[model samples]
Target: MTDLLLNHRVEGSASAPPLLLGPSLGTSYALWDAVAPELSIGHRVVRWDLPGHGGSAADLIGPGASVGDLAGLVLRLADSLGVARFAYAGVSLGGAVGLHLAVHHPDRVASLAVICSSAHFNGAKPWQERAALVRAEGLAGLAEGANSRWFTAGFTVQRLVQDHREADPEAYAACCDALAAFDLRDRLTEISAPTLLIAGREDPATPPVHLREIADAVPGAALLELPGASHLAPVQCPEAVLTALRTHFDGAAPRGMEVRREVLGDTHVDRAQARQTPFTARFQDFISRYAWGEIWTDPTLSRRERSMITLTALVAHGHYDELAMHVRAARRNGLTPEEIGAVLLQTAVYCGVPAANSAFATAQRVLAEEED
Candidate 1:
């Protein structure tokens, strides 16, 4: 776990459900001021600075660090706050963190809302170049473009631009590195939270299509596209964003078992439960809570995509026994013989021919028996 202690401020009544607000890469928790006061009326709103930004330390966001690493920092921060589960709203990189928590730490999220963000943030060149420029010339160089991209004239304010200008360059650059390597396209189905996606139609950085891609992927996710709004929709149109959030949180609570079945199938889950014993109870409970309830339940990646990755991994590691079981589960999860073979064939190149050959033989036998 990262020892990053984030600077945070809490608002509203403590008795209310916790609403954790995270800011964009170059901004601090102040990014949410437009909506926080209104949101605090019904919830305990907690806003925190990004690592290396504001009062947070820089050492925690090390080079080549994955999104999960930064996400762990949020979990630790929540732990310190004694918040077991909370609703989340984030912008840009902050939204990415919300996505991470939904996937890796599902039980910790009550509901999620991401604005001007995508599962896979492409265009590594620009992000990398931005980081390089900041390192070379500092925040002043990026300020003008950042201001224009982040907000439209409707709500554009100098203070927000200053937030970008005054951001710690090293920390901002580190966040840029994380964004460059971020790709969760295949894992989108793994998010189990009841989700809401907001997009700015005029935003050049992450357009409505990005929001559409995620909206179409995550099951039952709601989407709102703000006209004339740019990358920072929350800043550009806080009233709309806040309205959607209140409706989403109040509408429905996502069920874990239903999402688990959607991803893993009912028969397979029942069988696994039947095999559980007192000695293995804790293990079963843990995976059920975290893996199935939290991770697999996410609507980010479909069951078929997940099965392919799982089958390939099992074959690569020579976990044939589990592989065989997964083969059956894979079939239930909609993997055809041809698809399974393709995954194995692809695995062969990196894992070795003998492994693929063995996997093929077993997979063929399973398919043939099922057909018979």
Candidate 2:
């Protein structure tokens, strides 16, 4: 609320786990418009504008600022909101701020996702030159080329372009100064929080290799690359960006999806998603959130046990087609072919010979497919 804090909007339940979102330079928190709402369902989403962007005071940052300074401002905003440790995700410059926080103030970040950003902004000379250009002539020139720099050809988000156009010249230049001085390459390995890196394959500002470098350096870090996307991925490919963030942050349906893919394999899950229609979308969500998310993800029973139970239930109900799928899943869960036969035999004794006969035929077909 104070001038010292960055301007931010909060969504979702106050009691939910806190998630902080940061914006790239030349844009406002509105950059998250397409993705934040869905993310807020399971998180206390706080999306902020940089100094002089959106509703933030232009004086929050001045000339010769560092990314560290921007990070400090973000900390102030989080502290003012009574948030201690939070999951963080950011784009470009905002991502740089997250890297700084993860490196310098590890205690405050629970997990991190960096999108279209780098550990070192490709050295300081280009940023220094950009700072000078903005300070001398302002942001008009940059705004004019915003779409090309930020998104793929024939795609545009006018609000972001306008945000670039309206950004305060001095503050924007100060942000450039921050980028000029920023370099966290050596400290990347110091990041202890769980990290994820997202890259737009076509991004000119920071390419996929930048993200790969961080993924290689940070212990247990993961990377995702979205094809056909440019620098501003959330604006250009919100669904992919949102899915990445949600999976990293443990959103309910996304968590289920992760489990679903693990249990069923990517080929099957991808096919299911590809065939999804509006009428079936809710049903799919239900399966992900409940069947996979809650039931399958439960640690109380081993996946092997669940797979056995699933096979019995499908056979008992005479769902032969689904029985084939569960047969495949059973194999994935490490059940031996003989063990699967035992489960089917038990089902025959309890349910009926006719149902079990059909189930065995289906399982035999799926098992043969796997062998092939």
Candidate 3:
């Protein structure tokens, strides 16, 4: 389709890299609120509400739309933003989206992080039956059983249950149908991005073994088994999730750095390197380690989106020096001349005419020099 209307919010410094966060079927984008603040500090986190949930219309997806179709909707969003590639992380049905993207749209994915999710969530029969039940009785019918399966030992089910209870019945049913049809075990090896697979040992929904199957299939993928955690491990044991993300993103040769060099150019990088004295060394190190290495490398977001965020933040902060560098980077990241003008024009409204004028001046100069 030409456009997808699923509700989404992009937060963090416009200068930060873009990270896409997908919610599970029953919940809204609020599912990531706990971890978003920490992540947003380093990433332009894009939280999207699932279809028929939160701000999305209940019928945003038709009866035939599968997880692959859902992936298509996400890529459409990226295209609209002029984001050439991004990192992605999702839970449950959201995780299935990461899988589909990594398998089918590998070129657009920088990294893939799957949390408390599954490749094939149970057999099709259970999902079909759940879909039928919800269609007949609405989301209220699935609340109790779903709550029981999603958490463990002393964990309160009130909030999680509420997420399901408030869901749109028809949309929930469509998600169930999507799960019923999703099974990508055969194509696991096709995934090219750096991948992180997380599982909750206590999760009955998609147990650790199911996650192990995925881990075993995808070469070089790291699997972290969070002990005593349940299906909602991200909410139940968030620390484990954060730690794993850091380790994955902060590795020796981070995926983010590769994209960074590609976007920023060797001339810029060499200049930055030339100025890295001891005083400036730590400053550069922190950016490379945390900002570029960790946050940028997150398979959960994209490099193109990151360039956009950085450009916007520079405009907002009136940091024309950085803005000029990123203006050049933005083009390399696939922002068209027209698109870059649009970003600056939007900045004029929110940031001010002066900031945008400066940005436009720098961007126009860079575009002209490249043309020459």
TM-score of each: 0.65, 0.76, 0.67
* Model 1 lDDT tens row, 225-314: 988889877777766776677668755423555555665567866777567543454465466557767776667988788889888889
lDDT of 1: 0.81
lDDT of each: 0.81, 0.91, 0.80
Clashes of each: 11, 0, 17
Better of 2 and 3 by TM-score: 2
Tens-digit lDDT string for candidate 3 (92-115): 999999999999989998888998
lDDT of 1 at 203: 87
lDDT of 2 by residue, 149-172 (tens): 999899998999999999999999
User: Any runs in candidate 1 off by more than 4 Å, and if so which?
Assistant: 1-4, 153-155, 252-372
Q: Which stretches of candidate 2 lie above 4 Å from their native place?
A: 251-269, 275-286, 291-372
